[model samples]
Target: MGTFKIEGGHQLKGSIQPQGAKNEALQILCAVLLTPEKVTINNIPDIVDVNKLIKLLEKLGVKIEKLSKSTYTFQADEVNLQYLESDQFKIDGRGLRGSIMIVGPLLARFGKGYIPKPGGDKIGRRRLDTHFEGLIKLGAKFGYSREEQFYGVEAKKLKGTYMLLEEASVTGTANIVMAAVLAEGQTTIYNAACEPYLQQLCKMLNRMGAKISGVGSNMLIIEGVDSLGGTEHTMLPDMIEIGSWIGLAAMTKSELTITNVSWNDLGIIPSVFRKLGITVEKRNDDIYIPAHTDGYEIQSFIDGSILTIADAPWPGFTPDLLSIILVVATQARGSVLIHQKMFESRLFFVDKLIDMGAKIILCDPHRATVIGHDFKSTLKATTMTSPDIRAGVSLLIAALSAKGTSTIMNIEQIDRGYENIDERLRAIGAKIERLD
Candidate 1:
């Protein structure tokens, strides 16, 4: 249980660079197993979850080399497929939710894939049905070990076909696409998640000799290839962290610049922040946010109704950043309803904010209406436990804006996603220290 001790009411300044996308790294790392050739990747964020995944790969016998601080080359020329049947493999595969992805490539090339039920943020129930169902449609046999709590998918040779995903899941789509890339025939996926993470995966797979079309849309078509080859790729800066930084600047009344944000890949994140009355200035590829000394206001809909910030699929505001948006709204001039449609318990963290004096009503499991103090009342410091990755960062943002000292426990949840968050925040004048 790690802890973050923060001194509140402090201002932050200076420019910070967003880390390479964590979500993208998960999918991209797993794709390395698709080929036996050396694949070099740059801008891999050094976070706990990613490190754990890399270690799991090492255990499974992928040759990995750290060429630079944020770059690595991987070769699966002699991967130990037998490791997948070992108890150690079950422990390793259960370490992170992203471990579920390795199944796709393994099933495609080696005819089998097995993993212990994966683990991750406890925000909601993330079903693996999407991955298995899509793979089944491609002619893979799905199995489960009820007693051991394991999942298995195997196919001598996957035969791609049409699949309309029950839901547009990012990892699900990535898994299906990776399997389809080596299948026997054409595979069409409709209602696929087209998040930048998925798009990056598709483009990287293409570079590795896979044929995938519809890079940024809900529909994808993959033409099976015999095998993939090596390729070099770079990751986009994390948009979720960019959104968190923007919210932090407004909440702490600080002037901050987020550099190399890959503005084109950020989708509706900037405009969504703007709707909350924050000045999101675009200076080339960097995002410059000025101090909100005068406080910002929430903008109502054109029909004068209360603004509702809801999470939708790509080209819409992401659910991952809704917690940050809700926290930033605590000091805004008006009220807003945050609809976290994707996850049920994500709004449960609002009770911690209420304890700190922000006026918020948990309307339901999926929606919360927040009434902003507009900087009129300072949130009082409180001790709290981080619930999940997004919620943990949201609490951190709240602690930064509150009056007096605050302590946040279970900070490992925060580290799982954000890379050296406290160190990065401290560089910009944040009064935060890690308590070991």
Candidate 2:
């Protein structure tokens, strides 16, 4: 356990670069198992979850070499298939959710894959049915061991077919795509997740000799090939982190610039903040957020109703960012309803915000109403424990803008996603210290 003691009211000013997209890194790193040749990846973030996945890969016999801090070459030619059945592999595989993705590639090439009960943030129920169902559709046999809480899948060979997913789950789509890349025939996936993470995975697969179309849309078509070859890919900037920065800038009244953000891939994130009346300027690929000295305001719908911000599948507002948006709304000029449609318990963190003297009505597990203080009152600092990765960053943003010193416990949750967050924020003039 660790804590972050933050002194509020510091106006941060400077440029900071977003880390590589953690979600994309998870998918792409798992995709390395699709080929035996060397696959080189750049811009891999130095975060706990990602590092844990890398350690799992190493335990599974993937030859890994660190060419630099953010660059690595992975060769799967020497993978130890028998290791999958070992108790050591089970312990390592259960440490992170991304470890589940190795199943798709392993099942495609090695005929069998095993996963212990995976561990991740306890935000809500994240089911693995979509992943296993898609694999089963491609002729894989699936079984579960209740006593051991392990999942196993095997197939003589995977055959391509058309299927419509029940939901556009991002990790589910990535897993299925990796499996289909080496299967026998053509595979068409309808209602696929089209987030930039999945899009980048598809592009990287194509560069490695897989046939996949519909890069930025919900529908995807994959024509299987004999094998994949080595290729180099670079990850995009972490959009979730960029959104957190945008929220942080507004709440602390900081003039900050997020550099090299891959503006085209950000989708509608900037406009979503603009709805809350935050000024966002695009200087080429960089996003500039000026300090909100007069305080931010929320815009009502055209028909004169209090605005509502909710999350849907990608191309829609990302569910990962709603926490930051909810926090930023506490200081806005008007009230807005936040409906977190994807996860049940994600909104419960609002109780912590309410304790900080903000006006929030917890409608239910899925919804809350935030009435902004319009800068008339400053938030009172207090101690809090972060429940998850996204919520940790949101609390840090809130602490930075509060009136006094605030201490946040369980900062390891934040380190799982953000890379050296305290160091980066301190470089931009934020008053935060990490205590072990």
Backbone clash tally (model 2): 0
Residue pairs whose backbone atoms clash in candidate 1: none
Residue lDDT tens for model 2, 32-109: 999999999999999999999998888888999999999999999989988899888878888899998999999988
Checking candidate 2 for backbone clashes, the offending pairs are none
TM-score of each: 0.99, 0.99
TM-score of 1: 0.99
Instruction: Give Cα distance to truth, residue 315, candidate 1, Å.
Output: 1.5
For candidate 2, the 10 contiguous residues with the lowest summed lDDT are: 86-95
Predicted candidate 1, C-alpha RMSD: 0.6
**Model 1 regions more than 4 Å off:** none
**At residue 342, what lDDT does model 1 achieve?**
89
Q: Write the per-residue lDDT of candidate 1 for residues 1-436, one digit (tens) a residue.
A: 7899999999999999999999999999999999999999999999999999999999889999999999999999999988999999988888899999999999999999899999999988899999999999999999999999999999889998999999999999999999999999899999999999999999999999999998899999999999999999999999999999999999999999999999999999999999999999999999999998999999999999999999998888899999999999999999999999988988999999999999999989999999999999999999999999999999999999999999999999999999999999999999999998
The global C-alpha lDDT for each of the candidates, from Candidate 1 onward, is 0.95, 0.94
